[model samples]
Target: MVLRSTRLRLHVGVSRVHRWLALIIGVQLLLWFASGLIMSVLPIDRVRGERLVERVSPATLDQARPRAPLDLVLREANKPAREVRYRLLLGREVAEVELADGAVVLQDAETGKRIPPLNAAMARAVAVQAYRGVAPTPSIRAILTASTEYRAILPAWRVDFPDRDATRIYVAQNSGRIVAVRNGTWRLYDFFWGLHIMDWKNHEDFNTPWLIGFAAGGLALAIAGSALLYFRWPRKRRRNK
Candidate 1:
């Protein structure tokens, strides 16, 4: 009789813990399921803004065009170049020189004249050429710091298009390269991704303390519920002869 009482008390104690854990961890579990379902339903290409924008092909270098020798251009720059690349920027051939100090210098390939950093107008032009959607004149702004939406490069241009998707394109200021394309679809997907990962801010980190604590609680709940089930299940009684 004492053993049976001890078992009943143990069952009650485990049941209480299980209920508390369920109350605490149930909401997050639902959020995880909902976010996962939404993400799976959304097409990945639209989320990446692939249909809204097209990649700008690399400009072909014209050998027939009269251009200054690379050696002469490097000598005049007088900077220790970690790397150098030649590309056409808006029909003008230019040499992009990356210095040891991580600064990028653009020089005219024909005249070797130093090109200044891209201004707002130049950034807008780049964004326009890369964008495939038919939208009105886009609002241009400079993103000087890293953000959750645009994190690829610093000092980039954010060209906002007034379209259905609210498309935004990011262009690297120095390289004249389209870095990232973001739209309303991508934003929605990212929001759900943040919820799934339990990272409300930044939306990148998945190893937060909140996630860890909830995972531990969920495991405890499972164990306690299993114990309760084992104790409560009815056993077959022996027949009286």
Candidate 2:
């Protein structure tokens, strides 16, 4: 009788815990499901704004053209070169020199003249060339620091288009390259992703304390519910023959 009473009390306690856990963890589970569904339904390419970008063949270096020697270019840069790349910037062949201190300098591949940094007008031109969207005019601004929307490269140009997608293209000022493209769809997807991971601030970390705690609670809830089912299931009585 004592054993029966103790067992009954334990069962009641477990049921209470299960209900509390359900109440606590249920909302997050629903959010996870909804976010997952939304992410799955959204096409990855559109999310990345890939369709809006115009594909262009990379400029090839002409070996036949007369060019300044790489040694001369490095000497003029004055800084120790960590890495050097020859590429065509706009229409001119330029030597992109990455200095030992991580600063990038552009030099004319033919004359070895130091190419000036990209101004707003030059940045706007680069954005226009990279974008295939029908937006007539785009407002341009220089982003000197990293932000949530544009973080890949520093000292970039943000060109905002007045289109349905509210497209924003980030062009690296020094490199004259399209670093990142962001639009309205991406923002929506990012919002839900932040919720799913429980990292509202960064939207990157998946292993948060809140998530861990909820996961533990969910596991406990499942175990407790299973125990209740086992204990409460009906059993057939033996024949009284």
Candidate 3:
């Protein structure tokens, strides 16, 4: 009798929600599982156009030159920034400035002028950073934006540069050699960063809290609908053979 009763209950209680629940849970689980799998997968060195620079030896303290002061660089930027930090490495003698807007400039020690910059025709060579179209406020903003380049982050470290790249230079701090100097093209660095901030699957972005909240609303509606169906609605059954 108890077995018969239990069978009767299970027959009535088995639900469409449970049927679909497996599907929903499976999909969510797959996403989380994929995220885990993505991490466990080997870290790839080669990114589309850009190649990762191999780490080089840092110079000894005596060999590295003294770094220019934060005050001097801040003055050079000449803008109200969100933040600034600088580290002087005597070993490398390169001044590395990382701005919030993501401008990295390595300056010469003695002159404090920008090093590894593309030389323009006559007067505006120093300000050629604008033409790259990467900087939100490039050096040429004085001409283009009619204002100084907006700076958000100042360079964090200054190492020495042994030489400059005539057209391009994104050098490594330790070795003071170009890690990625511009030959001509941007190499499309911005698109990669955009991918990082935005999720890979959908460009629209469910990672955004607002979208999550919308999803939660749908979840609430589903729960409420299920509760109403379970308790408030009566089940009427026809006799089976």
Candidate 4:
């Protein structure tokens, strides 16, 4: 009789513990489920703005243009260039030279003059090349400072398209590299991603204190539930028999 009483007490204790833990961890579990479902359904390419923006083909250098001698251009620079390559910049053939200090310079192959950095018009033209015929006139906004989207790459250009998704592409000023591409779908995905990871600040870290606590609570709840089942199921079967 004492053993039976002890078993009943243990069963009630585990049941109460399971109920309390379920109340605590159930909401987070639902959030995890919802966020995961949303992420799984959305197409990744559309979220990345890949469908909205096309890659610009490398501009071909005109072989017919009479270029300045490499030896003369090097002498004009008065320093040994680490690397030199001929490429078309803003429809002009130029020698892209990397100096010892990792600085990139563009020297006009025809006149042997130092080509200036791309201006607004030049930047616009470069951005226009990165799209299909649908958005020939995307609003190009220049951001010299770091922004939320173009955080690391500063002095970049934001090329905004008027597509249904409102796609935006980031282009670097110095290298003209397409740094990032994002859209409305990407923003929605990012929102749920933050919730899923439990990191609202950086939206990347998953080892937060809140998540750890919830995980521990959930684990405890699962164990308690299993214990309750183990104690209750046999008793119900025996009562039926």
Winner by lDDT? 1
lDDT of 2 by residue, 1-241 (tens): 9998998998899889889988989999899889999999999998999888753536798989888888899998998999988887677788899999998888889998888888888878877887878998899998988865666878888899898999998878777778888999999999999999898987888899998888788789889999999878888989999
TM-score for predicted model 4 compared with the true structure:
0.74
Residue 232 CA displacement from its true place in model 4, Å = 2.7
Q: Which ten residues in a row have the lowest lDDT in candidate 4?
A: 232-241
Superposition error at 173 for model 2 (Å): 1.6
Per-residue accuracy of model 4 over 119-159 as CA lDDT, tens digit each:
66677676667765375477887888864455756677787
What ranking of all candidate models by lDDT puts the best one first? 1, 2, 4, 3
Instruction: Note each model's CA RMSD in angstroms.
Output: 2.6, 2.4, 12.3, 4.3
* lDDT measured at residue 40 in model 1 versus the true structure, 0 to 100: 99
Q: Lowest-scoring 10 consecutive residues by lDDT in candidate 2?
A: 50-59
Q: Please, what is the TM-score per model?
A: 0.85, 0.87, 0.35, 0.74
Better of 1 and 3 by lDDT: 1
Best by TM-score: 2
- Predictions in order: lDDT: 0.88, 0.86, 0.38, 0.77
- In candidate 2, which residue ranges exceed 4 Å CA deviation? 1-6, 55-57, 232-241
* Comparison by lDDT, 3 against 4, better one: 4
| lDDT by residue for model 1 (95-160), tens | 888888887788898888788788899888888887888999999999999988988878888999
